[model samples]
Target: MAPRPNVVLVVMDTARACETVHERYDYLSELNRLAQTGTEYTKAVASAPWTLPSHASLFTGTYPSKHGAHAGHKHLDEGIPTLAKAFQDGGYETVAVSNNTWISEEFGFARGFDTLYKTWQYVQADIDLGKIARTKQGTEMIHALATRLAEGNPVINAANAIYGQFFRKRTDDGANRTNKWIREWLANRNDDEPFFCFVNYLEPHLEYRPPKSIAERFLPNDVTYGEAMSVPQDAWGYIAGTVDLTDRQLGILRALYRAELAYLDRCLGELRRHLEAAGEFDDTVFVVTGDHGENIGDHGLMDHQYSLHETLLHVPLVVHGPRFETGQVDDLVQLTDLAPTLLDAADIDAPELRDASQGRSFHPEAEIPPREHAIAEYMAPQPSMDALRERVGTSTDNIERFDRSLRAIRTDDEKLIRGSDGTQEFYELRNDPEEATNLATERSERVDTLETMLDEWLDTFERADTSGEVSMTDATEARLEDLGYLQ
Candidate 1:
């Protein structure tokens, strides 16, 4: 068989389709380029709210329930047919470089890759205590910038760096460097076999640490009236504190966010340039997506790991490269479908892949299925629910509030979230963009309809068999610990 397209999957952490440079920021021109050059899915949703599960869903084309990694720290089941393994079986060389501990080798994320990298150039875990940026303002900006950059919104890059007092961009630990690594990887690689590379950049995850010049640039003057104070370090269940800001502060916060995104965009642009120059662009299948969305202060929320608001659940997914048409797709797609789509696009029979995986391939001009929703779930992976709670409070830790465990499904117009004990919440997206109103008490008929759908969906999802303990590895334990996944 002819060599299939080389696949380079870039999973930005919190990217949104609507915020791409195409939608707004010109500083992030490259992302717009990618979106315009290939197929963009405006309705894509990450299968989960956080990294590990969402990534597992992305890599395996399966949901959290199907893959069974529901907590902060868990590994992918090595037994499952991961995208890398499946592609490798079809004679492709696969590699992954990730900056999040959630995706470290300790878990199954590294299972099928020929090479996997999870540590960031500057992981928060290893921050030099003395050098660490500590002010709430600094942290808030950092969180915002990091989120913007990580989410593939490059417009925020410069703003983040500039706001953080940066006079010039740093290449060593900056977007340019990340792209350089990818360029080097692609340029130096001499494999005759088709190759798949997964490069996960982490500039955009929270506590928003960017380069030195990026964190300290914001202050009270930059904040809006509403955001003049830092949101408490800890707030709602599963919610973390943010650089509290009022409406006036949004400009600074947004500046930081846009700056970070711009930075990453430049980085991605460089990578794309290299890929094109190397004559690899048209021959490769390129993808960009986020694990989930971050809540940057909507509904009084600071960052992600909080409520299942659209700000947290809706994500960006874009497919470029070869064999895909240039157009927009509104069909609802879960992150899990990524694995199969890539394989199918390559026209390679993925033996390790299973129909049970939640992902389905999207071939250009093909009639897609009619699945109307996606599922996201969260739970305590270990006995130390408190450990997870400390970072993002759960009911076990915050009994006065609601339970932390939540399972939700989202459709185009509405969303439904159900707590384990049957406490439910509903929202009308068109009216409640902030998700401030809970309609479960008021919309009985809608709740019933959604509940039935949820039940049937759960049954179908369970049949996928993503349960039980992940085959453990010391690496997984260490990574989980670093990411606060393992206590």
Candidate 2:
């Protein structure tokens, strides 16, 4: 039998399809080149709208509901087999470099990794004692206090205004740092053993302060980080109709986001160059994808987990390797499909999943059946909504709507979003790609059929026994709060 090819999975955290590849963003040249050389799934969907669950789906080849690693259930069950374990069982070395705390070893994400590098662990080591509290426990307490003080106090707000500027400088860019580590690993790893490398790049996530050189390329010379930070940290003020931002300020925010993407693109190019120099480029299967998309003021939401809109669900999935057909694939695909596809590419059989994974390999040369629709789930009682409402008053109806759990199903031309509160929204994607209009009332028949299909599809997965809030260390919780995952 032929030796398995080395696998490299790149997860661009908070990267949106509309911003990265589908639109006129020329900064991602390397990714574009990969898509041209390989296969690009034009319409790929994530199984969840946020990190933990979406990433679990990608690693386990199952939906958030099946794997039960969503907001309702904060950890992946140990019983569920992951793609890393499958590869390891088949004699492949598995390694991971994750930036998000939710993907840390504490959460069962390190189950099969031979070498796991958590970027946050390194960040904690480099933290300045003066900027943050002296001790880890003290820092956690300060974070909790800050959360409380941020509610409505003018003094705290003023302090936050000042602290926000320095905060951007406190942390190093995770994507660039991770790429450096990957290059070092390539130099040290065994040449004979095939390896699976999982990298999570956090450059595109919040607090978008690109280096001055990168930022200036996108913005005017006069713009500064202070001007960008002038907009509310989470833009909750804009969402709740409290603070009004000038047109120039909004443009600065967009510029910062684009600048970060540009930085990420450069880092990706560096990784590609390193792989080529090591003579591993030809023998490696490269898969680049986004865990979930972000909402940059789309649908009046600042970040993800607020809504299951296309801005937060549609992500880029590009694959390049031997035996893969090149060019664009128009069929609908999910992030969950990536695990099985990677395993299949290596000629490895998938392990017996707890709730049989719904993903199928997209090996283009093979006669695999295409999916007609894609599903995404969001189980929310988002803690951020309360903080947003407290800072800026919003309607109770809006709050209720944002708090409701949601499930979405999308076809090539249509989408249905069903909320737990019994509210439904349907959009004709061809005409309303932005999802500006909700036609649920007008297209009752379509809604009914889609809802039935969603229900039937969901029925296949066995319900996980665990369902509750995730337990976290004080320091971990503090880190999540700093990242805006906690209130």
Output the number of the TM-score-best candidate. Answer: 2
The residue-by-residue lDDT of candidate 1 on 116-207, one tens digit each, is 64333232222121111212256675675455455333443334334223321234223454566667777788758788888877666543
Q: How does model 1 fare in lDDT?
A: 0.64
**lDDT (Cα) of model 2:** 0.78
The C-alpha stretches of model 1 lying farther than 4 A from their native spots are: 118-177, 210-251, 381-385, 388-402, 461-486
Model 2 TM-score, all chains together: 0.88
Q: Single out the weakest 10-residue window by summed lDDT for candidate 2.
A: 125-134
Model 1: ten consecutive residues of lowest lDDT: 125-134
Tens-digit lDDT track of model 2 for 1-487: 7778999999889888898765356677888888889888889899898889899999898887778888777888898899888888888989999878788776779888898886554332212122233232456846745664444553544344334334423644567668777889999988988999898888888878788778878886787766665665555555556666666776787788888888888888898898998889898999888998887777777768768889988899889988876778889889888877887788887567423677987776546798889999887655546665664666566565677789999999999999998999999999999999999999999999999999999887686666777776555666666667754
Q: Which regions of candidate 2 deviate over 4 angstroms?
A: 123-171, 220-226, 384-396
Q: What is the C-alpha lDDT of each candidate?
A: 0.64, 0.78
